[model samples]
Target: MADVYDTTYGQADYFGSEASPLLARYADWIPAEARVLDIGAGQGRNSLPLARRGCRVTALEPSGVGRAAIKAQAAEAGLDLDIVGENFMSYEPRGVFDVILCFGLVQILRYQECASLVTRLHQWLRSGGTLFLTAWHVGDPSFARLTREWERLGIRSFRSPDGSQYRLFLEDGEILKLFFRWQTIHHCEGLGPEHRHGDGPPERHGEIEVVLTRP
Candidate 1:
């Protein structure tokens, strides 16, 4: 299947060339040599930075365009990254990781797929490993527009008119319940920094951010 991000990332500087602010904010918490997995690693923004910090980063991007950009940048920077061009749902993890990043990822899955992916994350993370996650919630401004104008799959889940995109927003405190057993290092729910994708207008997302450690 043709991935949507292949088109989006093909655009000049789709997401720009910066690591996520949330990653920088929590950088001190990660071990310098930790094994890391960056899911939906669009344009390698977060992956490149982590690799530069001496973390062993595996960038999993389904978009061929995005993967090429990552490869190009990694080469220019002399950074060694394991770039995987496969959908997360089909990509089988080989070994446990010390840190896993899910920035701007979970919102793309269906409700059940989100839960299933959490279970997979639990299995992929080593004991005492860390998880950094950011996802949109129902309070996001776009959620109202999506639910009202798009094809509703379920509560807070919608498909775009042309059937090219899917989004599932979290309810307040909903994602927290899934990780009750983990030790929470940080957790917050609210609008995140303004950002844009492709040629879209400046936008904001009501998001949930969490940093947790496994037992």
Candidate 2:
């Protein structure tokens, strides 16, 4: 049920609390009437606010649950939104955007997907366009030990409380090293304990925040 499209889609309902400093910082990157793409946009947490700011937003989410959430929000606000119910990897954009907000969904993808996604994102971004991304970061020796134990057991997927299979790949420097084609203008690792909600149990999985731009 957790990983299925119906349950997996709209997060805007519960993720209202997930908005943190990272989102606040990314919001500044959005200009008035900017064209924004909210990839893995679950329920319009950032999308709703961005729309209210007068920005033209396209909310892309694969989960029906997520699509419904964004639909409800946009309808109530009378905001014009283009919602695409498809995977970010396969969806083709007709034009470039001014800013792309990719919050909280990076690790959901495998490393291979990240490579292609990075390229596609760059291709769809206009000159000097900005991209904001967040990823779950591995910090602390305790997490290292636990993950190592899992690896030793040859268990690749972590099962969450909701019976969903969540997988994570990148550790720390891997994402930057792999996706370095774009210039990183702003970077920061999230503060506090880790947060392994998607990858496994709802444990601590610290994060990395990156603001990149094309040359």
RMSD of each: 1.3, 4.2
- Over 1-215, each residue of candidate 1 has an lDDT whose tens digit, in order, gives 76888778878568777777778888999999999999899899999988999999999998888899999999999999999998778889889999999988888888778878898898999999999999888898898788679999987888889988889998898877888789989899998888788788998889899999998
On TM-score, the candidate that comes out on top is 1
Query: Candidate 2 clash total?
Result: 8
- In order, candidate lDDTs are 0.89, 0.70
lDDT of 2 by residue, 67-135 (tens): 887888789879888998888888998899998888877665555566688888878889888888877
In candidate 1, stretches whose alpha carbon ends up further than 4 angstroms from where it belongs are none
Q: In angstroms, give how far residue 185 of model 1 lies from its true place.
A: 1.1
Clashes of each: 0, 8
Worst 10 residues of 1 by lDDT: 12-21
The regions of model 2 sitting more than 4 angstroms off are 1-5, 8-12, 17-20, 140-164, 190-202
